[model samples]
Target: MKPAAFDYHRPDSVEEAVSLLAELGEDAKILAGGQSLVPMLSLRLAFFDHLIDISRLDELKGIERRGDALWIGAGTTDATVGADRQVSAAVPLLTRVTPFVGHFQIRNRGTFGGSIAHADPAAEYPTVALTLDAVMEAVSPRGRREIAAADFFTGLWETALEPDEVLTGVRFPLSNSRSGFGVHEFARRHGDFAIAGSVVAVRLEEDRVSHCAIGLMGLGSTPRRAAAAEAAVLGMPLGELDPKQIGELAMSGLDDVPADLQGSASYRARVGAVMTARAWTDAVAEAGGEATHA
Candidate 1:
């Protein structure tokens, strides 16, 4: 199958892109890396009357730090993000999770903002963004605004972005010296979408867990914060934490786990528990806290 006929507009600047989007309205789709959008178009899963190519817009093409957060351009590729020294230092969880995104070729073409905009429930970037409370910046002819990661994702492949808005970039809060991160997922093969996954960020204060954030993927309509699990480990001594118990708590509130050929809802819930536990345990260790369980 091939995508329906469409007009192509490549804008050199974000202002031009926003103007095009505003003019084209619902008929326009912003083309970034094309990693996910192209496939959907080719399969007839999606169609647009116009494609506004912002892939080369200079405004969306760098990795930089501003104040307390690291800002990543919407056009930055996954491979570039994974290899960036600044990202490795400021948001290590992104570095740790990027390798699991897709194959090398996919990573080379997949853009950070594209994945987030696509909003796949099992995508690595969204899970990381949610766990870190990343903020998404979007622009339209009307104006510009920021959307919190927690409120950005509305459902599978759906986001808070208005039809005329183009995501410009995302900002991730820098992790402190006492922070550690870990991510774990179950996929039948490398490069495949995860069947279930977990991302954990732990902040230690005086050998006690001060802050914990757990994000669960591939188990619901959108990547979900494991609130129950995060609350469970608060103020607990690192060594005394039980991975099994933490894992159970993570899945306790997952009532809408998806079921497909990959697995049943019950199966995914079970795998989710295991992944959550492993992620939590490894995150604690990475944060310089001792973990008794392997």
Candidate 2:
């Protein structure tokens, strides 16, 4: 099925894009790489009367750093972000999981900001953002505002973005310790959406697990942060975290996950726990002998 009829407006600048969105209101949708939206439109799963194309907005098209944080433009493609050494060094999470987003052709057109705004529960970037505690920068006729990654996704295919607001970029903070990151996902095919996935980030302070962040996708209504699980591994030696203990903590926070045809609540919860446990083990190994088990 083809998408319903819609008007397409490609703006050359950010201000113009925001203006178009404000003018179109409920009928408009922002078009970035068109990787996700186009497929939705073709399947008739999404309906928008207007398409505000921001591909030409040069202002929203770069990656740079300020202090310890890296700011990636919303319009920047995933391929670009994945290939940049700066991003890989600053936020290894972005580099580690970007290759799994889709095929190479899709990655060439998939935009970073677009994925976050789309808020697909199975998307890797949202899980990464949640794990990193990134911030999304958006602009609208009302004003500019920043939304925390954790607070951005209200539900599956829903976000905190107002109708007139356009996401401009995402800001990721650099770790202050010898941090190691890992992203893992299980899929039937190479480019298919994940059945279950996890992104783990561990920060070490003098050979001890100082801070840990774990985020899970394809197991909940939204990309979820395993807060209880994070707390479980903090200050514990990597070898000390028994699989059963970590699994219990990880599953503890998935009480509200939704069930679907692809997986039951129980199955997804189990996958979430398993993936997170593996990620924690991998991250701990990367920390060398500093990882402790008790």
Candidate 3:
């Protein structure tokens, strides 16, 4: 199947893109990398009257560090991000997860901002954003605003972005020396969407957990922070932590786990727990201590 016939507009600047969206209203769709949108269009799962291509917008293309955060342009490709030295040094969780997004070909054309805007529940970027408290910046005809990662994702394929807004970029906080990150997921193949996944970032203060953030994907309508699990490990001695108990607590509060042909809700929940445990354990080791539990 092919997409419905639609008008295509290539905008050289973000302002131009926003203007097009404002004028076209709900009929306009922004095209970044088109990794996700192109497939959807090919299947006729989505249709738009016009496609506002912003792939060439110079305003949305760069990677820089500001203060304590790394600002990644919305137009930056996943392949570039995964291989960037700055990304690896600043936010290792992103570095660890990006390779799992898709095969090399897909990553070459997939935009970082595009993934966040699409808000696929199983996408690695969204889960990383949620775990690291990344901030998304958007511009519109009205004005510009920053949306916290926690508040950006509303549901499956839904986000806080308005119809007339363009996502400019995202800002991820740099991890300090005391922090360690880990990401783990289960997929049918190397590049397949995760059936269940977990990302953990831990900051240790003298062998005790000082701060922790856990994000779970493929188990809910949107990638969600595992607040319950984070709270369970905070301030606890790393050696005293039980991976099994922590994993269970991490997902215990989730009641909306999605079920599908890939697996049942209960099965996802179980796998999610195991992944959370592995992620937490790996994170703890990376933070400087050997994990005592399996």
- The CA lDDT of each predicted structure is 0.92, 0.83, 0.92
Q: Kindly report which residue stretches of model 1 are placed more than 4 angstroms away from their true locations once superposed.
A: none
CA RMSD per model (angstroms): 0.9, 1.8, 0.7
lDDT of 3 by residue, 1-294 (tens): 889999999987888889999999999999999999999999999999999999887788788999989999999999999999999999899899998999999999999999999999988999999889999999999999999999999989999999999999999999888788888899889999999999999999999999999999898999998888888888999889998888898888899999998999999999999999999889988999778778
Give Cα distance to truth, residue 63, candidate 1, Å: 0.5
For candidate 1, the clash count comes to: 0
Which of 1 and 2 is the better model by TM-score? 1
Please write out the lDDT profile of model 2 over residues 1-294, one tens digit for every residue.
888899889887888988998888898889999999998999998999999888778888899997779999998999999999989888888998999989999999989998889888889998899889999999999889999997899987899999889999999998555777767787778888888888888877666679988888887778888788888667866556664567558778466777767777888777877777677767766655333331
Q: For each of the candidates, give the backbone clash count.
A: 0, 5, 0
Tens digits of per-residue lDDT, candidate 1, 1-294, equal 899999999988999999998888898999998989998899999999999998887779899999999999999999999999999999999999999989999999889999999999999999899989999999988899999999999998999999889999999999898888889999999989999999999999999999999999899999999998888789988778888889988999778999999999999999999998899888888889887675
- Pairs with steric clashes in candidate 2: 237-292, 238-292, 239-293, 240-293, 240-294
Question: Candidate 1 has which clashing residue pairs, if any?
Answer: none
Highest lDDT, which number? 1
Candidate 2 lands at a TM-score of 0.95
lDDT of 2: 0.83
For candidate 1, report its TM-score.
0.98
